[model samples]
Structure formats: structure tokens, C-alpha cells
Target: MKVNNSNLDFDSNATDSESERAAVAPVVCLENIHKQFGSLEVLKGIDLKASAGEVISLIGSSGSGKSTLLRCANLLEVPQDGEIIFEGEPIIWSGSGFSRKPSDNDQVRKLRTNLSMVFQQFNLWAHLTILENVIEAPVTVLGRDPLQSAAFGLELLEKVGIGDKSDAYPSQLSGGQQQRAAIARALAMEPRAILFDEPTSALDPELEAEVVRVIKSLADEGRTMIIVTHDMKLAREVANQSIFLHQGLIEEQGDPEELFGNPKSERLQQFLSATASV
Candidate 1:
């Protein structure tokens, strides 16, 4: 039904309802975040929040630190400064600045499991079948029963529209298929939120549409997601809060319609203008 549709349609009054839901508490919150690699600063004094069922899109040019911000939220890359709070718990940290890291291994692991990341590249195991790839982490890391995990993994694969390919190796699938498999893997975690880093960038236009369709279905189901994307249209369509990042800082942010249609910052306006032509 809804999942099979190519076009995404949202209720006209969803904004009001979503706002009410978001007022409870953010699932993930970042305050005054700062990240740097060597001497090159990536994210500078950034603040972000993702409440349950709210979709946030990070959009900017290359080197704008959108992906870096996502990584910090997922703890794939620890920020040199800032508080990373998940579901009301602040990440325990040790040291300061460049030397800072998460102090509690258990906390990091717990948070990581609750925030699943789907990367730009498929990142699937070539040797494992699609179903195995989907169930591997759940069965091993989460200690789920193998038979039950396999059944749920198959359901997730079907949800992503690749049930027929469950026994296929990643090498046998197209870029879009592999990415869908990755999405299934992320879903298998039953995470509180999903972090997407340029999820459609690796596929060609036709194949990209396939992945986009699945993402739209997820958005329709009100999945909490933070997406770093170059696809302006997808950002506008799926994101409730659209943030425009420039040179490692937030240039502007607001409702996607207002931010995209009536950008306040000149930088954001210019960025939209440039991306519109591509």
C-alpha cells in the first residue's frame, strides 16, 4: 500500500502534531559541539536536537561538516567539545579537547546500538548473504536468538523491497540493492533513531530513486532520523527541520518549507540557488 508508492504524501496538519510530539524530549541532543581533525576544524559550536518521530536534514556543500556532525551524534567520531546526550543521558567523557573520548565503554556501546547509521557506501559484507548481513549484528552484539533474528531480518529485507535477494551476496546486487540491504541491517537493530550519511549518493539516478522510495516510506512511518544529504529535494520532502551548514557552522535552520522557500541567510540562499541548477 503506502510503502509501494513512489510519491510521498504527508498529512497537511502533520506539522502541528509533530511539534506536539517533539515537545516531550529529544532522543538525541548536541550542545555547543566542536570537532577538529588535526588543526582543521570541522564542526564549530553546533547545537542540534532530534525528538522522537522528527526528521532532521543537514544540507551543505562539501567540507561543510554535515557528515562530521552525524558522526559525532553516532559517536563514530567523538567531538573535541560538547555534550552528546541520548535519551536524557549525557555521554560520559574523559580528558579534554583533542584528547577527549567517551569514558564508559558500556554507555558508548549501548548508545551506538540505539542509533543505527546507514552510510554512503553500502558497507555490506561481500561474502555474507543479504539475510546474514542483516542479522549479524543483532545476533552477535545484541545477543538475539539466531532463528528469531533471521526471521526478523527477512521481514526487514522485505520491508526494504529486497526479500527475493535475501540469499544473494552483496557482490551480486546493484548499488541500490546493496544500500537497501544496509538499511535493512540498520532496521534490524530496532534503534531509537537512524543516522543517514548521504544514503543515496552512491547510486545513479534510476537506482537512487529506488533507495529514495524506501526512505520515503520510513519517513511516512514517522521514523526518527538525522540525514546528511546532498539531495535537496529529499531533504525538503522528508525533513521537518532543515539545517543549512556552512563552513562547519549552522548558517540557518527552520521548517523546511520556510528555510528552502524564504531563506534568511544570504549564504543559504546562495547555496540553494547553486544546488537548484544541478
Candidate 2:
């Protein structure tokens, strides 16, 4: 398959006939978002959106708020200001500032149902086996059928190249296997949009490539995803839209080819230069 991110048109998979066409909306949208950690402002009046089947990548230096933005998008870190909308519905909130959160906890939970996040550290449950980890959320949070979920979970494990280790505990597997298991867990949710926060950061070169391969396959399948990563080459290969954040704000963003090929912002140029070998 030919992948060209020259214009961030991550819609190659949207090639449906007119008869199959339907009204489409962004899978997720963040509007004028702001976040702070006791006076350390992170995200500052930021707006981001990912449409169905689109792949987006966020890249920058450390503390540029790339991870923070991903956290805020999924409500892992509640933004003090701004709107988080999932599939066009704004998350219900009332209080202001640090106190801001979903007015109804249930609403927030429901919203999370449509968004899946893959963390930097493979946050797998040490107590559970690989298959169990994948099905736990669907069976518990979503109340899906455990028996059916198990069968499907096995399929996902196989897809990620760890099917044979379905019964193995995370602590028993290699770091690469564990991260792939985490990805299987996220896929089990079958979320509309998947948020990846440095999915391969914790792995060695070989292990990291394994996870990156899995991620690239997902992108080819038209899964909508927003990824925060330092892997510039992988970002360019897999993402259509690319964003560069600097000092709590977006410094530059556009098609990955344009942004990575000919960076316009001085900060982005410096950051890219710094990580060129990687």
C-alpha cells in the first residue's frame, strides 16, 4: 500500500461509494485546552482534532506537553480550561480551574468507552495473564461476554504476535511481548480513536521495532489514532498529520512530509535537528 502523508490526508481507507457515504465527524476534538501543574502551565489554549480513519502524531522535546496533551485528551489529566469533545458531544463539566471535571462521573466513564489510551510504560496488570488482561476491560467496564471476549482476545493476541503466550503473566514475557499485550488490550476495546503515549519508549531497539510494526499495521487498517512519540522516522512513515509542540503550545503542525521535510518553525527545526540520528 502506498502511504503519502504529504497533505495529512489519512483518509485512504474512506474510499466508499456514494451509497455507502454518511455524515462524518471528528472521532475526538480538543478545543482551547489548558492544563497546569501547580502553576507549571502545560497545554495552553490548544485545539486538536482527529477524524475517523486519520492518524496524527505529536512530537517535540521533553516537557513540551506532548504527553500532557495526550493525557488531557483522554481525561487522565483533566484540563483546567477548554472543551473535550468525543464524537461531537462535549464532556459535561461544571466547576472551573483545578476543580474542573465531568459533572457526572458516569458521563466521563461513558466517554472513555469510545477512547482507548496506550501508555508509555506497558501498564499491564501483573496479576493477570495476557489473554485475561485483554478481556478484562471489555468484560468488566463494558460488560461484554467473557467467553466471547476471551475468544476475541486470543485473536487480537495472535494479531500482535503473542498468541502463544496468552496464558503467560506479563512478568514472564519480554518487554516487547508486554507492550504488544498492552496494545491488544487497547484493541479489545475497539474504541473509535486510540491515543498512544510513546508506545515504544520503554523498549530496546529490537523490542521497540516490534511494537512499532504492530502500530504501523493499525494505521494501515484505518484506525484513528493520536500518537505522542520521539521516533521521527516512524512518525513520518505512519502519520498523516504531524504536530510539534513547544513550551506548552503548538509551535508548528501540518502534513508530516511538510513539517518533517521542511520544518518552518525555528523551534521545530532545532528539535528535529537534535533528534535526527534517531
Candidate 3:
């Protein structure tokens, strides 16, 4: 749990020695994160760390604050209390309690670019082609050349097994295809880590398998990721670390194998049984 300051800044293009040192530090760290909507508390004093090439899965029942925790990681939803650190740099805040918000827009923007989020709903632009959806942010936000972005976008789409449907819009694709396109779009950012919020929940079992395969492939590639999912099978299969939340706090967490097969917490055992019956 000790974070090394020497590994604070990570550069993919760094020398081998630097990369080795950087691998020890977390790409993202959340400390004592607390969030509440009006009077309803969602997260309470949560702490999480994701190092390079680490896949962490958050599994719990609905209202356990899984989605809110993901949003807070990229500053999509600011926590009223706690620290959000990216590459060891703490986020600057402007106010206290309910009015608290990130103080610097530029810093938030920089961090967000490295933390790509894939929503459960596949929030793609219906008017744009699949390829366009993948390249838009890289071109507009990062100022990359449109031509090169399109080329890379196509490569990403191909990687996601949707090269033939690059010209199709979100409305024209099946839910599985659309989700794959969304995954490709997330890859287009070349993010340090990808955050998946129930990426497979929107699809039927057959369609869900498609996304699961892609996610498992990413894990095999050593991609740093945090997944919030209801599918215990996917969590057990792909995650290096698995965490179970109950009433806004981590009830139990550890290696996926032990967590799933020999869960010590009664709540997690109950949860696994219920999901199994579903």
C-alpha cells in the first residue's frame, strides 16, 4: 500500500529503467473518497489504487456506488470528501463539502484524457459514423491530424472486430457491435487506464459474450483497467483484484480466485449465490 514517489510520473516512451520504476506506482489512486447526493450517501471512505497493467473489478449490488466511484475517478462526478490522485498528483479543489469542485479545468482535462470511460449505454453519436465517433475526440481535443486519426481509428475498429462497420452509425449497429465500437473509441484515446461501467449489462447473454471477449483480450494485453460489473464470471475471469462493495464500503476484496471461490465475508457469499440464481 506504500506509494513510491520515484514512480510518480509515468511515461510510456521512457527508458526501460524508468518504465520499470514507474510500474510500481499507481496510475490512479483514490483515498477516503466520500460522495453523497443531497442526503443520500453513496460512497463512504473508499480507498483504491490501480498500478500499471493492473485490472481491478468492483462488484456489488445496485446502489453500492460502483458507477459513482468510476465517475469520481475521472472527475465526472466530484467527491465531496477525499483525494483523487493521477500519476501521484493530487487534484486541486476550490471549495469545501457540497460546493467542492476541482479548482483547475486544465488539470481535470489532462487527467480525463488519460482516463477513458466506457459507459453501459454506449454513448455514441448517432449522427456520426462509427469511425468518426472513434476519432472525434483525438482530433478535436488532442489536435491530432484528422487523416491520421481516421487511420488509427480504423485500426482500432479493426482490432475490435468491427472494421467492416466503420461507416455505420450507432443506430445501424447491433447492441454488441455498438459496444465494441465504444470500446474502440475508448482505445482511440490511448488512455493510461480504461474505466468500464457495467460494459456488458446492456446486452443479452449472446451479445454480452462479444464484449467480454474483448475485455478479456485487453486484460491479456496487460491493459490497466477498472471494471464495475454485475457479471461475476467476467469479474472472476479478467480481474487481478476483485472488490465487493456493500452500503458504500468495500465489504471484501482480494485475488479474484480466492474472492470468488473462498469468499470469507457472508455478504459476498450471499451476493454470489443470488447472482448465480439469476
Candidate 4:
């Protein structure tokens, strides 16, 4: 397939068009993306485009490959086929066939730094304080001074509303606090975009709101984000657009209000109705 390169350009000159036209150029573009594990295909010819600073939510039932697609966006899982363009550059897929040339380890690391991921598990280091957890990556992997990294880390913690918990270890913090700290860590990398995989799924309802508030603030700041979430309310409120995935394929996608309030596909209508009841 000849991939369309027009949607990948993000130059300032391209921004002079009408607001809607400017918004159409994607900051993140995925075309013919396919992922499989053994014989089970996870993502089948998925195509998605997200504009600069847009929040695109991926929503679906469990096992619908929403999380898998998010992972593939950041190269956490090597898709068997497809092209992913981030920040105007095609993500060099290291896997076999049709994808771009294999990226070396150094190149892969650099690409990952541009795309940070926040997981549901809140994967913080047990021994490190919240501050340390956020600064460790910049200091070690990025090779910045620890003191400089710590300063930025604190700012990120404050941004996520967890600056007060900076000195506390992960074990000492509540689940919500820990997840906020994890988000801060991702922000500390100064990524071009963030990928979230069910960020609030592990939290209780009360705790979930706290993390969602931080995400809302990020969206308000115009940070590009791709969130894989089952929380329909969050999707409806936070997302500028929503994509409905069903059985590893995109069932329907459009403006959040249109997709949620008036779904176009029978599969999406059924999925939403079933989920709304639960």
C-alpha cells in the first residue's frame, strides 16, 4: 500500500489554513498497522490520525486490542506490519517486513524518549522516593546531572499535584498518589506526546478522579495524548475524539459527542449500550 505522506507534515506554514484544515494534519498517524501474537491477530489494518494537541481516546470492551494498539504506538510491542508517524517522522519499525528499516538500539531509545508511556501499574521503584523515581530516568538514561534532573522532576510532581509527596516512597503513598507520581515521571522526560494504557483502571472511583483531573489539566495545556480507557465518562469528557475498537478492528470513530450520543455502527451501538448498563 502507498502510504499517504501529506498528513504527516507539521510545519508552521501548514498551520496558516483554516482552523479545521490545520487541525486535520496529524501529529500522530498510523496506517495499515497490524499486530499479532502467534496466530491470534491483535490489530488488523488499523488506521488512525490524531492532530496536534488533540486528545484521542481509545475505548472498547476488554480484550478488544485497545491496549495492544496503544502499546504499538510507542513501539512497546513490535507490530508485525504497519507504519506509525510521530511528530512528522515515521516511526522506524524494527520488526520484519513492509515496515521501515530496523532501528538500532540507540535509535530505538531516542524514539522512545519522544513518546513516554504511563501504565496502570504505576511501575515505581520501591526503594526510591517519589522525587527520585521521577528524576532517575533523566539522570541515568538521558545522562543529565542528578541535581538538574531533580529540579525538573519536582516541577513535574507539582504539575501532577503530587509535589507534597515528593519525599515519600511509593509504598508510603496511596494508589492515587503513586499513579500521579508515575505520570510526573513520564512528563519529566519532556516527551512530544504521552501514551496512557488504562491509567485509572486500577484505582477506586474516588482515586480515579484525582488522576483524571491531572490528565484534564494536561489536555487543557494542549499536550497531545492517546489514552486507552474503558471509562466512558472519562472518554466522553476528556477526549476531543474517540475511536471504538471491536474484536481488534476499528468499529467506528468520530467526534466524541457524535460517537457516544449517536453511534453510526451497530457494533458500536451494541458495545456502548452493553457497557452503559454495566
Q: Best by lDDT, which number?
A: 3
State the lDDT at 150 in candidate 3: 95
Residue range 1-278, candidate 4, lDDT tens digits:
11111332323233333355464556677888888887888889898776667788899988899999988877778778888876557765454844534476666677678778999899999999999999988888899899989989999898888889999999999999999999999998988788899999999999999999998888888777889998999887788778899989988876788789999899999989999998
- Clash pairs, model 3 backbone: none
Query: What is each predicted model's overall lDDT from 0 to 1?
Result: 0.89, 0.87, 0.89, 0.82
**Candidate 3: 10-residue stretch with minimal lDDT:** 1-10
Each prediction's TM-score versus the true structure: 0.92, 0.93, 0.92, 0.88
Task: Show model 2 residue runs off by greater than 4 Å.
Answer: 1-22
> Which structure among the candidates has the greatest TM-score?
2
Can you rank all candidates by lDDT, best first?
3, 1, 2, 4
The backbone clash count of each candidate, in order, is 0, 0, 0, 0
Runs in model 1 with CA error above 4 Å? 1-24
* Candidate 4 clash figure, as a count: 0
Give the alpha carbon lDDT tens digit for every residue of 1-278 in model 1: 11111112222224555556545557888999999999999999999978777788899999999999999998999999999999889999999988899999999999999999999998998789999999999999999999999999999998999999999999999999999999999999999999999999999999999999999899889888999999998999888888899999999887888889999999998999999988
